[model samples]
Target: MSEALEILKKYWKHNEFRPLQNEIIDTVLSGKDAFALLPTGGGKSICFQVPAMMQKGICLVVSPLVALMKDQVANLQSRDIKAIALTGGIKSDEMIDLLDNCQFGNYKFLYLSPERLQSEWILERIKNLDINLIAIDEAHCVSQWGHDFRPAYLKISNLKTHFPNVPFLALTASATARVKEDIIKELGLEKPVLYQESFARKNIAYMVFEAEDKLFKIEQILKKNPQPSIIYVRNRKSCLDISSQLQTLGFKATYYHGGLPSREKDKNMSLWMEEKAQVIVATNAFGMGIDKANVKTVIHTQLPENIENYYQEAGRSGRNRDKAFAVLLTSPSDRFQAESQFINTLVDKKFLNLTYNKLNNYFQIAYGEGINETFTFNLNHFCSKYNFPVLKTYKALQFLDRQSIISLSQEFSEKISLQFIIPSKEVVRYISLNPNGEEIILAILRTYPGVYEMDTVFNSALIAKKSNHPEKEVLAILEKLKEKQIIEYRSKNNDASLTFNEIREDERTINRVSKYLEKQNQLKKEQLKSVLDYVKEDSICKSKLILAYFGEKDADECGICSYCITKKRSPKDPDALSKKIIELLQNEDLNSRELQNRTQTSKDTIIFALQALLEKEIIIVKSNNTYTLKS
Candidate 1:
């Protein structure tokens, strides 16, 4: 057996590669730069991973999100492949140590976020490593035309100058023709071999409906499908509201969003991922780390911001190649709100400046200070304190980060923890007083013995299960212990973090990136328009249109999309009545009444035929509601 195939089998347990995967691997193996446009669930990672496994050097992967990096690292480790993801919340010494390990230790894969590339120390160390292959996942982010463009990605081009001999493999799930070409140019890939697999998901049925009552529509869709499904909403509030409505209707449903506490997010995600809940309602935050292959349906409660996003999210279903459905429920208000929320309300340079200054004030960072300082930014608290809209505030911060003014990381769900402060003997004596829910108290003591020594993650659910008490009661007992000064309790939190890449310079810093901000704002507006156009357009085949938009012009009809199904059901061809009308017209002029009396079809159907004939110009409307031969 070939070494590549053998490695794939031994590590991934796969005897063969997916479509186009082997070709991509071969191109990379030849030491040529390659760009791979594989759709979601297309196994893009294996294209680089397997090649790296066959080689004797480390593979450097620059991923965008922390969660994605961590997940892939964990997966690699599970297969006993040594991998490490250098992300945030680590001190300089720790990062140096990790890098030292990568240099000396035999870690096969090194996953680094794009933001990490901005650090000169990291770049210097990476240049010294025996990096044989450089893989850029989510490569479309390099394109200004792409939906999630990050300026940090542009710095990746610098790698080519240092590791000029190393082959660069760029992979993205979705990208337009412009974005694809732009990715090549931005990354400075030298005559890279480009491979684009068809973005069309044949196993996914596209269903679009104009929903007057979204709740009723959701309930109906859930009742009919009843398989594992994901419902995408536009906001955290709607996520909770819809999930609650579904659960009240007796469907096992839960919600996930950035606003939820860490434990809640984990619990909800576990329920949905384990099939304990049939539906998971969430914003765009739920799909990055998901690997469920049996998702029968993906419903969008509101318009997606772009076609690329919608396709990637909907394509999550039917990964096992079973037939699934991607349904979009839209109201006129939904479109309007999408437009208003995303386009009309984008933060301008002025707003960006205001937001920048307000943020420093919020963090209490003095002017000309706070360089290289990191702070846990509670987005909700910042918005509430500044009386700014949460979504706009978030967009502004993202823009600031993209412009390299600051580095903003994804929000993390931090768990509540507790540690016993008193001595073991004092703890025993206090607990002997029957502080309440002795079973839960004992669970804490037994489940995590080191809690007395250090802060340990507190799981109220497990305690509740063991104590035969409600989760609320478990929390209450924990708080009671905290009140008694017996244990230190830290509440669960959801907070994003921000690191000032430069010193606080207020308006000067915001002005430095004003042009860049304007450029990104325009990109976002154009991307939104693309998605809205898809939602409103009903005549084109859903698959055909999307494929064409992504630069696949020769795509045929999917034959099962909503548009194709409706086209097949409709009588587009000339009916018998229409044929009769043409025959009558060949003989003599005929009025509507005359046509109805002469044909066996209904009056409306006959008139419809006459209109059809008139449109063809084989017959002409001589007068109002009258017809005659054009000749």
Candidate 2:
């Protein structure tokens, strides 16, 4: 067995490697950059992780998702493997300590976000650490064609010059040929060995229903497939609405979204994963690295923004390679809504300029004054203040961020924290004087003894439960403690972190990145069109259609898809209808209506047959919309 195989067995307890995983592992082990294209739950993490373990030095894994990084770090730690994630929301001292531990404590893996790669303080520290390999997860995000493109990812290519000896391994679940080429070009991967698994998912039956009542369709699908499932909606409100509807109708369902408190998200996600909740209704934010194996159904209530996103989301089903369903319910308004939300929002240079000036003005930054400045931004407040749509404003900001005008860190829901400033002996004296809220103070100390040593997460509800008081009373006590200068408390509402990477410029200079922004915006419009095409398609097999979109040549049709299944059981069969049409047209020229009437076939069937005949030159369409036999 290879060294990587031995390491995998020792750590992950996997006896065998999935298809192409071993070859990908060998490519990385040979100090060559490799791009591993695996499907969701296809074990993409293992390819990098196994090789990282067998190497001599620490593997610096750069990713953009903080929650994903957190989960991976926790998993590795549970197995007693030395790993740490240098994500956002860490204090300076804590960051220093974490980096120090990695350098000296023999940490095997250090995960950092791409935004952190640009920070001189962090990069300076990274330079001193002995590194073996650099793994880029969700590497598709580096390409503009990807569903979730981040400007910070462009900065990751800098690592090549800094660590020339350290090979890079980029991994993503879904990427088209264009996106794959872009990832290689953008990341400056040196003659990277590419491993692309076939995108054919035979067990997943893709179905698109243009129904008027989506709720009724959802019910039917759930009843038909009563296993663990996920329902992906567009926003947070829909998640709650659908999940509540399911709960009212006697279905075990839970809801999750990005806006929910982290505690609530964890509870709901856990309930679904552990089979306590049979179905989970959520937005697209839910399933990044989820490991549940038996998701039998994955439904999309509306059209997705692009094929990349739709493919990734739909691929969540049938991870066990068992029969499962991926259904999408669309309405007449879905097409218009998708176009309006995605294509119409494309900002030209003028809109970019206007939003750029408004943003700097809103932040109160003077021209040629603001450089290396950081501020807390609440996107809702900003949009509400300027009457800007949330989606458009977010896109504008992201475009500018990627253009290097500013730096936007991952938006984390801040937590309520408190640290005692007083001496331990004085704490008792203060409590004696403030006896009205003595129980709450003692509860805090009892629950989090380290709160005095460092700022720790303070749960008000847990304190209320322990103190036998209302949550309002608990909040009052914490505020009173802060008033007495006994503790420093931070509220929970803190949101976005915005840093001006350059000095504030006049509106004229803000258009410096307009050409680049325009190109990206146009690319987005094309991607959205591809998604709409997928939704509107009805002739080809859905499975084969998706495979072809990802550059699979001559993909075989999946017989289980709704298209193929419906074709199998149709009354107005095209083959039979074509024969009848040819028989009628052979005698005399006939109008389309007459042809359909004579053949006793549906209009769609007649039209399909006529088109096939026209393509084959067996028939000709003369004036008056009539078909005739070609002489």
Candidate 3:
């Protein structure tokens, strides 16, 4: 324990360990398996990191998130701790070299995805390494009932055969009782010590509000709490639209989504992190592995599919132990949307079979072939080619990837090359006739000096920026130039790749994993139902409800939740509220949200008071949605 603490101090500059971290670390150091269930921002990484550092050999950490793996590896390197991540997209020779480095480089940590362990050669190489511990991050994925179930995780138990004595540590931020049991059973942990911290966050007041005008409500929430915040939307378009709207409404806001270029994502995230932007409107892609203390509020504008996701995302706030809010803004249409988006898009065995058959056909794979074959997969292009629904097809591909039928790598970017075929004088004459192509051609020629000499790779985004046009427009101009034989052009539009792990027995493949797929679909429905219940159940305390979902029983009512506040404010005093509203309006015009904030009451009470005042003609609503006392 002393050694662990010393390592923590030396590297992290922290004197004391967080709750439950010490016990988990002690269990691992004693050569015993451990299961750790800590909430977000509870310092889960430190438990495995500090303990692994105290020992001699490398710790093999299996994680499902590539972004998180890169971040941790970078962070450890910055602190001079030797670490390496065996992520995807590496050549076979490069992967072997990395394994060799892990064997002889005196590294302390080796991070890789669970899917990487599927290869027998890799497993053989791993057995050769002097491993001290096996830490499984996001261990809930091993469970069938877990929110993010991956079939590849079940194969992790194979490690026990290779290294019988190495202790395994399983860690997760959010897991239900079933998930916990499954993690223990699937990981083959031998009488592991379990450390579960309470899921309750006393500082966060979980509140659910049904709003007709959600933007107005969001504005009210943001206006009242003028601190660093995150507003979660459901899609990339919404991220852009809502952030733009907020900026138009005079808020310092930025946007983040998965489709954004990495540079843009980092810049937008930095803007919000450095306080240059007060809020970041983003999709679910933004907050994993992020620790942002002092976030006063987290608002979700749409309905989340499950409670686990909502809890993990909302838990990002109030880490500094300050009073914060987890606000969920719902509407009458949210339930239908949730069902249509989540439930309807769930791929069953039939859809899976069709997708697998079509995919093999698209690549012209023989029935008994395509094992270990890889191809660049453009999702939009495939969907357009087959006239398949984009969402359902994507889900099918993901299902195949999860079932280990194929390894889908979404990190693949298109390779493009260009070379001018005509001389400079011919190009100038062509540009004079084709004025629309002039800017893009000039931008590319200016950017790439040797376009006429050889095929030069270029960034379309940079060309678009230089030409003051959208990337799509620039691509179109280049395609036109290619058609006219003015330039040589080649581009692969696929931003993803798929590697088949099995032969193309389409029906057999789908049949093999059909049961798991059906069970997953059912589990998703149940999870969504729980989320709907949480949102609609106004009688119970929201915080207690979340705790109970995570198997925490007999929790006391959180005094700060909407239900507790409303329950305490029973026997409504309508007349008194109306009088309060009149007095507030006499001083200055205010909206319902402002009145609710100032009066420390609910929106219903404020609305009721304003309606009563308007009925008596004592107050009137101004053009800007504020109520004012009649002159």
Scored by lDDT, the top model is 3
TM value for model 1: 0.74
Question: Which pairs in model 1 have colliding backbones?
Answer: none
Candidate 1's C-alpha runs over 4 A off are: 261-264, 357-390, 408-512, 570-631
- Can you give the TM-score per candidate against the true fold? 0.74, 0.77, 0.84
As a whole number from 0 to 100, the lDDT of residue 430 in candidate 2 is 89
lDDT of 3: 0.89
- Tens digit of per-residue lDDT, candidate 1, span 1-631: 8888899999899988899999999999899999999999999999999999888879999998877888899999999999999987888999999999889998889999887888889999988899979999999999878888988899999999999999999999999888889999999999999888888899998888776778877887788888899999987667867877888899999888865557988899999989999999999988886789999999998888888899999999999999999999888788778888778878998889999999888888898998889998766556656777766877888887877778776544434778899998887787788866577888888877767654565655556665778878888888888999988898866566789888889888877788777877887788788787787888898888788788888988898888888778655345766767778878777777677657644344666777677678877786575788877
lDDT of 3 by residue, 1-631 (tens): 4888899999999889889888899898889999999999899999889988988899999999988999899989999999999987788899999999999999999999998998889999999999999999999999989999988899999998888888999999999999999999998999999899999999999989888888888998999999999999998667877888899999999999876668998999999999999999999988987888999999999999899999999998899999999999999999999999999999988888998999999999999999999887777557656778877988898888888889888575435778899999999999899898888889998988767865565667667777988879988998888899988888866578789999888788788889999999999999999999999998899999999999998899999987887788775588887777778888888988888878877767778778878899999999999889898
Candidate 3 at residue 444, lDDT? 90
| Cand. 1 Cα-lDDT | 0.84
Q: If ranked by TM-score, best first, what sequence of candidates would result?
A: 3, 2, 1
Clash counts for all predictions: 0, 0, 0
The Cα local distance difference test for each model comes to: 0.84, 0.84, 0.89
